[model samples]
Target: MLQKVPKQYLAQTRNIFHCNCKIKIPIEFSEELLERAFEVLEEIDLKYNSYVSGSYFSCINENRGNWTPIDQDCVEMIRMIKKVSLITKGHYDITCMPLLQLWGFYKENNHSLPKKDELATALEKVNFRSIAIEGLNVKIGAEQEIITGSFIKAFAVDKTIAFLKSHGVADAIINAGGSTISSLNDASHTAWKINIPDALSKDVFKTGLQINSQTFSLSGSIDNNLLIDGKKYGHILDCITGYPAENLQTGVLTKSAFLGDVLSTALFTVPATIRDEVIAELKQHFDFDYFIIDNDHKKIVTECFQYLR
Candidate 1:
């Protein structure tokens, strides 16, 4: 049980399923514990995934007017979705699927920008207000469904960390794709240091995150992208305009990558005029620290980012 060797597995079909992860679970992780961890990760992928047609959100959309109340796990995720939506003033909405599908980020069909009239039409179908949730029961209006599959990475990290800890994984780190979460035991000697890719170049390393304690989540658009009409498009969608984020090149460092990943995506779509206000709001609500990389690739670090170093 005290062995130093670690086991590594690559999931074949999640969003970043193509991206491999090096899991540093303890040797004491029993066969049952390992199976449970895999099952938990798979469930997170299945229940929260947006691309899957049979997923909860997709099921709700298919059943529209019938109205189905999700289980507790979904309720919790929706709660955060609503909270973050309000904090971002609707810029971080989860109901941006219409716009997301129209743009073809998942489909990879690479459609051109929609005409103003077309965009306006799609925008009509996009509204977070259409979703109504009361305790265990959630109802979707005639035209809306909740999609938080993308939102689940951080949640998965949180849930996975909880699972690992419950299974006696005291000193462990779960790196699901680029999202990283870790817990340290008093006896563990090393800090978890993760290196982020450069905002400008993947060939070069940009910065390092060294965590002594606490949960951290991060999302950025340095790598995931497409080029249309000579303009580059990042995977982070603008919930307001329903288009890929183009302004912010990369975002790193946050209190919860769960929120950080969502914010990083939201920040990409936010207008320059309101960024200062957004930053202030983030600092006020979550006590989260951030490091934002602008279009020019300049780094802006919050007060607590020093701890990440």
Candidate 2:
């Protein structure tokens, strides 16, 4: 039973999935301040929207071979996504558009196991490495299309926070569809308390996953709708297999929600033999922290989180 709290405001402006958006700011702010925040969400709905076939990114996908030009914001986002993909060792990729179309997740159609030959062909056309950005110019292989399903949610949080900060609202929390970004501690330094939901159950978060001014993103299969023949199928797909990852689910918390989103998606696809190496690489590149739910449903926290319990 997921209940809405006072700070929650949901609108169906985006795609069909309920965007459980929440925001909380100090009481000192005026009505105009809150209105500005709402406007930011609506503005994002018009641009960067996945449902609209004519969006900037969508048009790039349609004209796959053309030198599709992109705005600075979109370019910056793609650049950051690429950097994170490198750190994740290709576990998460945004260039799986062909495979996504075959699976029919976007159109709410029945899920079927794609033919081996067909999926292989789709995979051939789907490689993030093929898409390159040069300043504001975007280039992709003639057969490939770009899809930002993995990064868009977290990016939205980033953009929303920027909008809020620009309006002089220094203290706030924005949670959109389970992805969150925030500057806790009110304008006067009072802390904000947030509940981190238990992965096993939605009853309540056992303890808080705190942040003063940072981004946090969680990706897991425990809460997905891939029910086929009484078995569940998750939304996170393995770019390697062109199939949903099985057995393990992962959650990553980082200074940037965009990176967390990629790591969670990528780590889920890493084969058991190389998971340790991937973790080691993450440690080397960025100050990242993670919690992995193993095949046996055991929770293993990274070295940075030993005191959470």
Candidate 3:
């Protein structure tokens, strides 16, 4: 008699959220299951992707200042985003789309930093408080727009994880764009190992993390930035200042990938002096750990963060 060997299966797609996504399962899974997981991602992209012309988010953006009917899911997503915005004191705002455009982040050829007046003008429209929800309808301040780039991918990953778990997946991992990663039950595979790269050097590994049934979201300015007049400007802008945040990198680990994604981005924009205080306030509502690589290249980590190396 021969011993049975466990089989692994992998699925990958590049169209979701404009980044390469991958899912790996330790146990042999049906192709239909894999396709269904990818379908989850595609549905999210179609509904919430702000760049898509006819997406629900795009519709909301296009009708700013006017109430627009939205699905229950969209209403819930906005509520979650608002809760985080209130907790972060508006540091993490979806209405920062104006600021992104001011910095020419959405355009390929215009990569210059915004002028002071331009930044100030853009700042006027970047307020989370301006977003309103009326039951299944939503509205934003005039000239204000929402961008789901920060957490939509992670939300999709979370949905996929739930879908996989419903099918009895014992061990699985989903990696979204090398930034947001989520895992299902790790009972079969002890933990998933993830590498943290140097902010300036992609080939160098700064540290590694071990996550079990958790999600890790990393926010960094190294690879996504604009170079103008020999000066590099990051894409993650501060909603208050209408300028790029000073933090070079931020990582968050949480049970919910959506929470991790929003927290990582919010932490990146927060000043270092009060970051711990903000984390403390957030911990009151959610359980998570974080690390920050400041502008000075200082590494700060929470006590509970699991390090593999």
Summed backbone clashes in each candidate are: 2, 3, 0
Candidate 2 local Cα displacement, residue 101, angstroms = 2.7
Estimate the TM-score of every prediction: 0.84, 0.84, 0.93
Model 2, 121-159: lDDT tens per residue? 988886777778887878888987777666666666666
Q: Model 1 residue 227 lDDT?
A: 69
Comparison by lDDT, 1 against 3, better one: 3
For model 3 the TM-score comes to: 0.93
lDDT tens digits by residue: candidate 3, 94-202 = 8998888878877887745678888888888889998999999999998999999998899899888999998988788999988998877655566888887777876
Highest TM-score against the true fold, candidate: 3
Candidate with better lDDT, 1 vs 2: 2
lDDT (10s digit) by residue, model 1, range 34-103: 6566667777667766556777767777777666767887777777667767766777677776776666
lDDT of each: 0.64, 0.67, 0.85
Cα RMSD for candidates in order: 4.1, 5.1, 2.2
Angstrom error of the Cα, residue 265, model 2: value is 2.5
After superposing candidate 3 on the true structure, give the runs of residues whose Cα lies further than 4 Å from its correct spot.
Answer: 1-7, 306-309
- Number of the top lDDT candidate: 3
